[model samples]
Target: MSSHEKLSAAANDRKARLAQLKSLKRKQAPTSDEADAAPSPPAHQAEISDAIVRTEEEGEAPSVATTYLSGRNYDPTTRNVKLGFDNLPIADPTNTLEYKAQQLALETKAQQEAENKEDNGLDLFKLQPKKPNWDLKRDLEQKMKSLDVQTENAIAKLVRERVEAQKVIRQKKPADGEGEEVGMEGSELVEAMHLKEQEEARDRRRDEEDEDGIYRAKVRIGTAFTLALHEAISDRGPCDILESVNIRSNPSVRSKTRWKSVARAWI
Candidate 1:
């Protein structure tokens, strides 16, 4: 084979290996991002961990230093500090301790004076009493009672007027003649009259016939009367005699009476 062909084969092989590595890297990229974006710690745990880190970084020892003495070493155990005020020779021969004690005493006196000034500036006396005013509750109650009485009277008067007006209207409008007649006669009374007429007519025809037909007619009429009485009494209290009479007169219910009577007698 020629040198150019061998070099081409070698280049193809290298390219294939590079492509394989690239594919592998693509597959692992998502896992890398997932690892980097791990879930955050819980809030309470994070706070506690942060507190521990801060406490470790900042030593936990207390430093006994008073602001009154600058550039002075303070004993942590005794919580005492020596002032450097008199370290340099000056017009005063008093020791640093004595000067520090005088400064402390002056500061204490000033603080006490400030406290006294604050206390004296405050007014501790009770406030003066306000003038007595009218009782709103009692006033409102009296007004409500007055209004209730007035409203009740007005309502009563209005109702009375309306009732009188209705009475007048009723008096002026006469009842219909037909309705009045029907009301007076009643449905039951009319039905009873009709039934009685029918029975009388039947009896008259039966009398004209021989004995057997007359007895049958009498039996039929008796049966009809019994059925009507039963229907009226079936619902509640014994059928009102007046109501039964009216039902017998009623054109609608009256027609069924004959059939009901026959059924009753047969049974």
Candidate 2:
């Protein structure tokens, strides 16, 4: 349709709605006769309803609820403590046969549990001691001791055999002036040379041991004397201490002391 027809139709519809709303308002309004016959509300309630209608008409602010069906009536500083009822007996019917049977069953079950809790004989407090780091040394010491004893016994046995061999050689030795051509056999000569070599080797080892002992004694004495001199000269003049050391520590005196220390170590 054309724009002018659409506008006219919309205005006619708006007029029809306004007329219908006015008719409904007229029907809902109380008539003068009905207003006189109906019971009136209290004066205070009438005032409150009039105030609510005026608030709704004004455009200043929205209205809020002024009356409450349920309201708080406690003081701000007061605490609400709940009373305890733990001492009160249970609400179950205690005199009944079923209740008594249940109580007896509970008691018997508790007694059975108590009797079953007997001693198990396990001691939780008896702890084993921990093994230390030096336990390795402890275990090896016994084996080392056995080995050393075996070595010493073997050496002693070899020494005894050598002694017997040497005695036999000496007894069978030919006299220097005898004309008899009684000479040592090749095996005997070889044995004699081997024994001589062993003796030489043993002597060399002994000499080395003696030298080592003497050196050790010298080192120990020198260290001790140095420590003692250092302590003694702590409060003395350096020049005087040096002079006294130079005078007292002669080569001959040092040699004598070294020998004394070595003798003591040997003893």
Candidate 3:
């Protein structure tokens, strides 16, 4: 394409890309609805407006048995009657005043009986302690005996220490054994035995240096540089070979050749 056409195509592509980005951003924005714009508090159940309990109507009216005669002039089938002074029944002279004497006598008897039975109950006394079993007593006795023994040992040690601290207290020298018993060995014999052992050890010094029985193999990192320098300068050869090694430098020499193994064990 020509330069002008390429530039125009590039500009068109850039504009198309910008338009697509703007459309994507618009799709990501939030809606304007009240429920969607901001968060709202959770809804709760409505409060109860009425009482839980209800009572029956108790107007100035009393109910009676329908089958019994009321003994006064009134309608037999009437349900509710308004209470008034004229409609109130005459109080019987016998029923109310007759029970007063018996009620007083009963009240006196009840008060006396209540006073006789008045007690705080058996909560004041402490309960008896439970008896210990045989095994528990035995274990307790054993522990006590052990404690006694430890205490006695401590006391005896303290007494002995105090006695030793007293300067006037003298220890008795032990009496010599029977007069004819043999005497102990002299120091010369110990010296002679020590010299013999030294001679034997000198004879086995080289074996002690080589053998694993008498010598401990050691590898220390701190002396690594010094050891390398020491080994390089010293005339010490490699480990003693279990087999042999041979090189093919002089091939024509019909000498018996051993394997040139690289398995050199280090000390």
Candidate 4:
């Protein structure tokens, strides 16, 4: 069909439906006399009907029961009223299980942090002290100084023992005179013994020189250079200091005298 015919048919259908609705309303609507003589509705129902009619005429949807009641005479305090802060339904939310759990977790985390801090402070592995470079240098210097002192003391002790041994050997020479006479019956044996004594004395002299040289070289450094040089040089003809001081006479007295001289030189 044509567009014009289709449109005209739709319009006719709409008008027919409207006419049917008007006839139905005419049949169903109450007559004027019936409306006037009919029993009046209850006051509350009349008010509801009037409200609904007003909303409909104003092109607005009917409000809910709560809205309608609120628009009229609504007093929320009547049913579930809030008297004061203490009368609230869920007053202390802090006492809830979820809140307690959250608080416990936070407290546990804080306690763990505190314990970790304390452990870090006290733990030997973690509590390493960080010394400065200067401190380390000072400690090293002190250790070196102590080691130097110990070495000097050890050398001095060895020298003292050697000197004591030599003294004992020298003292035993007198006691061997009787045996030496009996043993020296032959000239060849006497000459050999004499040569042996001379060689032993030379070896002792060479050992003494070597020992003094080593002591002087090893100890002569910094403040001890002057003292060691003075002690290594003899007063007689620039030879063994021990011989010049007559170490065999009174060694302790000579050592004390040497210290006094060093102190005087410093002063």
Candidate 5:
């Protein structure tokens, strides 16, 4: 081969070897940096989740102590402890003279206010002089006089009506010996008497019919029996005959008669 061609071949071989070495270095590089650049772990995630577990066998976290101190820091003038005042071992702290003085001032102010309120309420009850007004007694007396006059008028009207009613009654009353004469005339008074007599006659006929119907019903009932006797004697009629007589033989017929008698008395 020619020298130039051989030199070109040598250079090509060196370039190919250099390229292979570069490729090998890239493949062999550590992957940790790339992984770290990709993304970081979230802060809220546990650092050693599966490895560490909370258990009762381990000691608990310390309890936080509560305090009731009011100041930002300790005051040497007050001789207050550096620790929180709420944590100080004192009971009934209000027993201090300053606290008692404040309480007494509040109570005194409340009492003064209560006294002022009571005084104001009393002022409301104080009687002020009434104005010279119209005389109520005189006005009432005048009204009473007027009412008496009205009452007298009302009574007079009522008396007049009663007198008129009594006159009408006297006029309408029949004289002792004039009853038969009044009935003999063919006037309205006689017609009224004739109507009254007709009503009374109708009532008497109804009573007689009722009595006859009662007697006939009783006789019918007695005839149903074979031994009982029934007899009815009325002032205006003859006696009813009992065809059969069974009630006399029945002992319960006496009790029935007593019940009927009681019912009639009640009616």
Candidate 6:
């Protein structure tokens, strides 16, 4: 036989075999009428329905439901439906996803509230240039005390120098042509002291009139005047009415005089 004839004959044989196989399968399998006449078991029926649904899903011509309704009563509720999340809003009756979303919202609100609270935003305790209150107070007090001591020492040195100057004037002889110099120096010293007192009094009165309401110049000036008087007495022997007034006002002068007298006696 020619190659073309053999090929045509093989094709015809394949078609015949396929047709026989299909006929044999049709004869063995139950048809829709036979299925209606004899009821199938519940499990077998469910399996058959599942297989039909699977086959319909794979077919090109789609069907919403591929179940045979002729054998049993048709149930509209049993037909398959096309469900997609493309159009419908997402929702779950179980409350799992909604609960999670609500929980996240609550967490975000809590964070916002915490951030809005004043205490959470600023840390008052960690301020710049941090120092303990007690330590700062202690350091300031020490500085003030040191400054006070330094000021007192400077004032005392000035008083001692003045006293030395007065003593030198008193020791000089009048015949040496120094009498005029001594009188001038004493007058100037006394005048300066009087002017200082008057200026201090004016300052005190001015302080009272000032809006700041701070007053201290009076006590300071009086203390300085008293120190000057004491130094003068030590240098000039406290012989005049002024010296008597100073001794009356500052009775501590008597103890200083007694201590000086004892030292002189011992020497």
Most TM-score-accurate candidate: 4
For candidate 1, lDDT tens digit of each residue in 1-267? 999999688667745744554465457445667768978668764554444344434754112132122323765456666555646666665657888899899999999999998887546485565322226446767888989899779867966775676566557767655465446446645776798799879966754564566568789988876765576455334333433443434566646664443333433
Cα lDDT of model 4 by residue, 1-267, tens digit: 999999688667745744554464458778899989999789775666666556655877554442236433444446343444545477798989989999999999999999988876456775775433447558777888989899779867966775676567657777656455444435544675798799879977976776678667666543464664455443233333334344435556665456534433433
Write model 5 residue lDDT over 144-211, tens digit each, in one string.
89898997798679667756765565577766635543444336446666887998799779767766
Instruction: TM-score each candidate.
Output: 0.16, 0.20, 0.14, 0.23, 0.17, 0.19
What TM-score does candidate 4 get on C-alpha atoms?
A: 0.23
Candidate 4 Cα deviation (angstroms), residue 100: 2.2
Cα RMSD of all models vs. native, in order, equals: 43.2, 34.2, 42.4, 31.3, 39.6, 30.7
Better of 4 and 6 by TM-score: 4
Mark the 10 consecutive residues where model 4 has the least summed lDDT.
Answer: 233-242
Candidate 3 residue spans exceeding 4 A from truth: 1-130, 133-135, 168-267
Total backbone clashes of candidate 2, pairs 3 or more residues apart or in separate chains: 0
**Backbone Cα, N, C clashes tallied per candidate:** 9, 0, 0, 0, 8, 0
Taken over the whole model, the C-alpha lDDT of each candidate is 0.59, 0.59, 0.47, 0.61, 0.53, 0.60
Worst 10 residues of 5 by lDDT: 48-57
lDDT, residue 209, model 3: 53
- TM for candidate 6 is 0.19
**Candidate 4 vs candidate 5: which has greater TM-score?**
4
lDDT, candidate 2, residue 203? 72
Off by over 4 Å in 6: 1-152, 162-175, 211-267
For candidate 1, give the lDDT of residue 64: 16
Best by lDDT: 4
Stronger candidate by TM-score (3 vs 6): 6
Local error of candidate 1 at residue 97 (angstroms): 99
- Worst 10-residue lDDT window for candidate 3 reads 45-54
* Model 4: how far residue 129 lies from native, Å: 9.9
